[model samples]
Target: MLRVMNERAVFGEIFRLGKVSRPELAQATGLSKPTISMALADLERARLVRPIGLRTGNAGRAALLYEIRPEAGWVLAVDVGREFVRLALADLVGDIAARGDERRKGGETPAELVARLGELTRELADEAGAALEDITLTVFGTPGIHDKETGSLQLAPNLPGWERPGAIELLAGVVPDTPYIVENDVDLAAVGEGAYGLGQGVDHFALVWIGTGIGMGVVIDGKLYRGAQGAAGEISYLPVGEGDPLVNRGRGMLESVASADGVVAQAARLGLEGLTSAKDVFDAARRQDPIACQVVAAESDHIAHALAGVIAVLDPELVVLGGGIGVQAGDLLIGPVTGRLRDLVALRVPMIKASTLGTEAVLLGAMAVGLTTARDLVFERAVAQAPPG
Candidate 1:
C-alpha cells in the first residue's frame, strides 16, 4: 500500500514554487479535484503545508497559494570534531534557527560528548521556541569510520577512547526515539557543500579539508560516493614524505606530508619550534615570516602534488578547499596546488575554490541528512498506511 494520497500532497508542495491552485495540482498529478482537495486537507492537518495568500492570474479571480511548512518538523545536527562540538537546529528548508559550539578536552569519551550534545540540543530547541518532540530526526558527523551495520564509531585516531564499547549505543540512548544517522565528518561536509554551497551546480567535485588531519570527500554525478566499507576518500594515508621507516609507514602516506601535523613535522625537521599548530604557521605566513613562508610553501607543494593525483583520477569539475587551514590559505594553496596539477594533467585545471560555509559545513550536512531521512520516513509511513490497492 503506497500512501499515494500523502505522496501527492508532499510532491505538490515540494514542486509548487508559487501559488498553485487545486486545478493546477489536479492537472499536474492527473488526479480529480476531489482527490487533490483531500490531499491538501490532509497535509494541512499534518502541519506540513499551509495556505499562503492567493495567486492572481485568472481574470481578477484569486486562487489560493500553498507552501510547505518550514517549521512543521525540525532537524538536530551535530558535528563532533577532535577539538570542538557544534550543534544546530534547522528547519526542513535547511535554515539554521539555533547554533552553538563548545571546545573539548582531547580525551573526552563519547558518553561524555553525548551528554553535552543532549544539553545543547535541548537548549537550541528552547531558543527556537520548539519542543524536543518537534525534532523529527538527528544526524551527527564525526571524525571516524561510521559502521552503518553496527552504528558504531571505529578507528578515529584523533580521539582517544572513541572506539570503546557503547559509544553509539550511549548516544542513541540519550537522543531516544529520534531517527539517528552518523557519518564521517569530511563526507558530511561534501554533502553540505553539494546541497547548499559552491558545489551545488557542479556534479563532480572534491572537498579536501586540511586541518589537524587531512581528509577528503568525493562527489560524482551529483552524489556523495562513499566507497565500499566507507573508506573511499581516506586520502590521508597516501604516502608522500620521508621519516623514520616504520613510523613514516605507520602514519600512512598523505598524512605524512599534507595534514596539519605533517606541516608541523616538516617545520620541526627544519629545526623550527615554538609553533603551536598549523594556524600559527598560517598567521605567520600572513605576516610574511620567512620560516612561515617557507614552511607553508613546502606544505602547499605537497598538497598540490596530492591534488594533482586526485584531479588526474577523479577529473572533478571543481576542487573545494575547506577546513580552518584550507579556508584561510585560499589562493595561497590554489596557486601551488593548481600549478602542480597543471603540470601533471594535460587537461585544463578544474575550478579551485574555497568553501563559503566555513567550519559549519559538517553541521549543515547533518541537517540535510536529517531532513532527507525524515522525508523518506514520512513517505514510508504513508505507504505502510495506504489503503490496499
Candidate 2:
C-alpha cells in the first residue's frame, strides 16, 4: 500500500510537471532518490511514462527527464448539438489525435442520433489509428442534464425521446467494452471555457448560452455548481421574458423569446420581412434595418433581464455569452445588454464577453472532462497490472 501511494504520487508529479528529473520528482514528491527510482521503474514497466531526454543545462551531471507517455491512454469526446454532432479523440496529454463533425438531419430521433454516435466513435478511432477498445474514457455532451439516478436525460426538449427512460442506458451501450459518461452540453461549454478560454483562472463566472436553446453554466469558486437537483443553470425556465409562465410551452419561457427560434418569431411578430433566421436579422441590423434593430434591441433587453436575475443570485465575476445566436450577435447585444443591466442590477455588473471557444466549447469541454478521468483510470490500471507490495 505504501509503495502504491508513492508510485501514485510520483506519477502525479510527473504528470503535473510535464517533464521532470529524478531530483525534481524527489523534491516535488518528498520521496528519497531510491524511492523515486523504484516508482519510475514501475511506471516505465507499466508503459504509463517514459524518459524523454537529458536536462542539459543542469549544474551537476545531466538529469534524465521523464514524461507521461502521450499514447499510454486515450479519451473520446462527443458533442451533440441541435444541428451538428462533433467527435474528437485525445491522448493522455490532451493532444487531439482525431476529430470530425456531421450535420444532424431534420427530425432525427434520439435512437437515430445514438446510432450515428456509435458510428462516429468507430470512425474517429480509426482516424486516430486506434481501436474502439483503445479508448480509456468516452464522454458525450448532450443538450440536457443526465439524471445519474434514473439514467435518463432531463430538460432536453431539443432532442425528442431523449428524456425517456432507458435513453441514457441506450446511449451508454454505444461504446462497446468501454465506460461512457454523459454531460450537459452547456455545462461542458463552461468547463471548456475554464480550461482554454476567457474563463481561465476566473474563480467565479457563468457561461450563458443563448442559441437554439437557453441555459447557463455557473462556476462558483472554480467549480461547477449544479443545483441540488442538477438544474442550477436551467435559466431558460426563468420568467424574465414575454408572456405568462402558466401557459408553459415545452421549451422554457426565456428560451421561447431569446433563442434563435425566438428571434425569428419576434421578427415575424413585428412585421419584419425576409428575416427567417436570427442570423438574417442580425445581418439586416448590421445594415441598419429599422425593423431588425428593434428585434435586436428587444432580444438584448430579454438577455439583460435574465442576466440581471443571474447576477442578483450568483454575483459571478464574468459572464460569457455562447451558443449560435449568442456568439454571432455578441457585439451588437453586449452594449444594450450591459446598458440595460446597469439600470436593473443593484451591485456591480460582471464583464460580459463573447465566447472565445465558440461552438467548439462543448467538444473542448468534453475533452477536458475525459482527460481528467482518463489520467486517473490509466494510473489505476497501471497500478493494478503490478500491484505494489
- Top-scoring candidate (TM-score): 2
Model 2 lDDT per residue over 1-389, tens place: 88889989998888789988999999998999999999899999999999999989758799999999999999999998988999999999999989998998858877788788899888888889988888999999988788888878888876788777777888765687788888889999999999999999999999999998989999999998888888889999899787533233788888888888888888888888776789999999999999999999999999999999999999999999999887998989999999999999998989999998988999999999998889999998887788535
lDDT of 1 at 261: 73
- Model 1 TM: 0.89
Q: lDDT for every model?
A: 0.77, 0.89
lDDT of 1 at 82: 78
> Where does candidate 1 clash, by residue pair?
237-253, 237-254, 238-253, 238-254, 239-253
What does candidate 1 score in Cα RMSD to the true structure? 2.9
* lDDT winner: 2
State every prediction's TM-score relative to the real structure: 0.89, 0.96
RMSD of each: 2.9, 1.9
Query: For model 1, how does the per-residue alpha-carbon lDDT over 62-116 read when each residue is reduced to its tens digit?
Result: 8787776777667888888878989998876667899899897667676777777
Which pairs, if any, clash in model 2?
Answer: none
User: How many times do residue backbones clash in model 2?
Assistant: 0
